[model samples]
Target: MTLDVSEADHQRVSEAIAVAETGTAGEIIAITAQTSDSYHDVGLHYAVAVLFFYLGTVAAWPPLLDWTWALLMGWSAPPSERAMLTLLLGVALAKFLFVLFVMKWMPLRLALTPGATKTRRVRRRAIMLFKAAAERRTEGRTGVLIYLSMGEHRAEIVGDAAITAVTTPETWGEAMAALIADVKDGRPADGIVAAIALIGEVLAHHFPRDAADRNEIPDKLIEL
Candidate 1:
């Protein structure tokens, strides 16, 4: 998958994160993923559906069965059960392969994937990234990760333990909403900047910067 965020956009978001961090001890990290998961299970589902439909059509239409039998028998030999089963299996395999091929396109694959499954995968990926890149990196455990998965059309905000202790998850709703809106409009950089500003406001309220506070994490947009 191609990245929607460009280098210039990355720089813009990096600047926004820097500006936001200037007023608070909180560390904000923005990340965008082309996709959280391949959703191969969805492709498998389509293949299964195709197999069942092909089999069902053959079973329901006696004329189709007769045609297949004649084709297999060369119009001279009597139709045998073995020949019919072979033809059915071969056709089913071919149809399943065709379905799989069609689902290779990203749009078709995403469309076939369930919304709930996408959401779950996106959230799980966000949490994993927060742990790997943001959590425990801050001196005061005031790190927050803003993650967006483009293919799934999902966004999540994950805060470190210290930040979550003082701020509820609901507090990030506005930032998340703003980010999602901009992302949907194909302005991922704008979304990140907006989300950073909102998150900065919240962090400033709860973890205002001190004279001795130091920047602990890099303020750059990470693309995956």
Candidate 2:
């Protein structure tokens, strides 16, 4: 959604404004697209956790029965012999391994990459410019990731496939929806600047020119 900009709201975002970026100098789009894509994995993990709870507890009868038997068995072991250590370990391991796809590795798969969001030159421009503006970078061979930002709140994702111009309300909405969908589908923020430019074009027709933009030059892309 476009940044809400009532006078009071502007003041709030001006204060709360937070920008996030990732990837490397040459891999900004890859980083943003990846970051956008990560939300899905987070959601997937959330779902799997629910399923594990249900399957491990309610769906199976054997564990409950085993536990009941253990309780009935006389002096199975000293009460002190049992502890939550195993349960704690299992939870920690699960969190470290599965359900943390981004945590592990999902490589910066850029839209510029085949089968990426959109590979058209225009799309690539949007992705590149957006990342460049934000100064994204990939740290190294390791899967380590970072987000860098200056004074930005709204994010846009643009591509050649994106509408040529944000000339109308419907087009504006489409642009907004696309970025949100990218996040839903786990895309990146590389092209977001182009998308915002497109929106600015739309606003130009109806609203007064946006007050002077406050966004500053992004820091140089680095291994972050």
Candidate 3:
């Protein structure tokens, strides 16, 4: 899935972040990802399911296979055990290829993935990005990461330990809710800016900028 953010939108968000940070010592990082995971395991599980289903069908209706063989060979005789095994293997191979083709369509692959799995992957990715990009990098450890995965329709807000100590998760609820609402409405850039504004307000209230404060992290949004 394409992230709806444009170059203009990136500049706007960067400006918003720069403005937001001026009021506080807190450092904010915004990241958008096309997807958090490939979900290949989900596809593999689907293929395995198809294999089992075909096997069960063959077992339940052995005559169907015999009829297939007869049609192909133009003979009514029942196949030998070896021939029957070969036919089952061929069916399995066909099913595998068919599932591989189906898995190429991302929507179908994602649909086969469990909701819990998607949530776990999104959260894990957000945490990873937070650590790689912003964790403990700020002078006062007042760093926060706002992460969004477009394909997964998931968002996460992660605050550094110092910020987390002073602010409850509820402090971010309004910002996150607004961001998600905008994303669901196909206004991802608007959602991100709104969330940043709200975060800026909270940070300004809790960690107002001091004369010694300096920008420790870049303001531009990160896209993956």
- The residue pairs in collision within model 1 are none
lDDT of 3 by residue, 118-158 (tens): 99999999999999999989878899999999887789999
lDDT of each: 0.88, 0.34, 0.90
- True-vs-predicted CA distance for residue 51, candidate 1, Å: 1.2
What RMSD does model 1 have? 2.1
lDDT of 2 by residue, 1-224 (tens): 11222344323222222222111111122122222332244445554665476446533553543453356565465323243334334444555445445333334222112333322433444355544543323222111112211111123433221123323335556655544544443332422433334444443343332344323323222211
Residues 51-86 of candidate 1 have per-residue lDDT tens digits of 999899988885786786677666766667787788
Q: For candidate 3, give the lDDT of residue 140.
A: 87
RMSD (Å) of each candidate, 1 decimal: 2.1, 16.6, 1.7
Best by lDDT: 3
Model 2 clashes, total count: 21
Whole-model lDDT for model 1 versus the true structure?
0.88
